[model samples]
Target: MPDEMALLVAEVFEAAGVLRRSGEAIAAADGQTQARWQLLSVVSEEPLTVARAARRLGIARQGVQRVANDLVREDLAVFRPNPDHRGSPLLALTPHGRRVLDKITRRATEVHRTLAADIPVDEIIRARALLHRLVERVNRHEGDGRIPPG
Candidate 1:
């Protein structure tokens, strides 16, 4: 079982690298990096503090803050005073950011469509479910120490 798990982890890392590269290209179509693209998409649904956005993206808050600052400087997004939290402001996309994000999203959608043309939708859903289960298990006991040898 451990060997199988090790194999799965290897495959997952490889898949992640491939996806990140594709995502970077998609984002570059709108003059953005994948990290900035991710942040913009995350806040598109609703405003969120940088910390919250970082948590959602599973990255460091400091990295998100830097991206948010750059977006603010470029007028792509704006930081609004948070009513819930005085010190931490919420980040929301501006009109221009929305357009950029929309373009990137459309491009990504087309790319994904072409890539998944041969794969069955059911298989994709099953794969996603398995990944989610694995993530959940890892999150639950990630720091509990190494697994015992059988």
Candidate 2:
């Protein structure tokens, strides 16, 4: 069981790398990378502070902050004052950002349809369920300090 779990973990890492590269390709035409696209997508519905976005994305706050800064520089996003936290402002997409994101999303929808054309929906749902279960089990270890630091 342990060996099986280890193999699954390794496969997950490999899959993530492939997916990241694919995402970059998907967003490249829009002059955006996977990281920027993901960051924008997360905060599209509502503005979020850097920390909140980081938590939502399961990544470090500093990385998200850098991406946010880049987005702001490109005029794709803006920092608005947050009443909840004066120190950490909420990040929102500008009008230009929204337009770009919408275009990207439309393209992505078509790409996803093509990618899933050969795959059965039930299999995809099962795979997602398994990954979610894995995530839950791994997260439980964090509470008990079972995960070792790099």
Candidate 3:
């Protein structure tokens, strides 16, 4: 069981690396890095504070803050006052940001269409379900100092 788990972990890590590299390439055409693209995508749905965005992205708050700052500097996003939090402002996408994000989404659609052409929809659905289950299991054991040996 442990060996099976080890194998699964290795595969997941490799897959994540591949996805990140591919995502970087996809985002690059829009003049953005993977990190920036992720941040912008998150904020595009709704304005969020840096800490909130970090939590949503499963990353460090400080890192998200830096990216948020950069996006603001680039005129891609804007920081608006948060009514819920006085010190932490909400990050929202600017018009330029929305335009860029739209372009990226269009490109992503094309990429996904090409990639999914040969892949069966049922297999993709099952893969997503399995990943969700894995995430749930990991989250349930978070900070417990140990994971049960499957």
Tens digit of lDDT per residue, candidate 2, span 97-117? 998888888888898899899
Residues 1-150 of candidate 1: C-alpha lDDT, one tens digit per residue? 379989999999999999999999999988999999999999999999999999999999999999999999999899999999999999999999999999999999999999999999999999999999988777766656554322
User: lDDT for each of the candidates?
Assistant: 0.94, 0.92, 0.92
> What residue runs in model 3 are displaced by over 4 Å at the alpha carbon?
143-150
The numbered model that scores best in TM-score is 1
lDDT of 1: 0.94
> What's the lDDT for residue 109 in model 1?
95
Regions more than 4 Å wrong, model 1: 143-150
Show the colliding residue pairs in model 3.
Answer: none
Best by lDDT, which number? 1
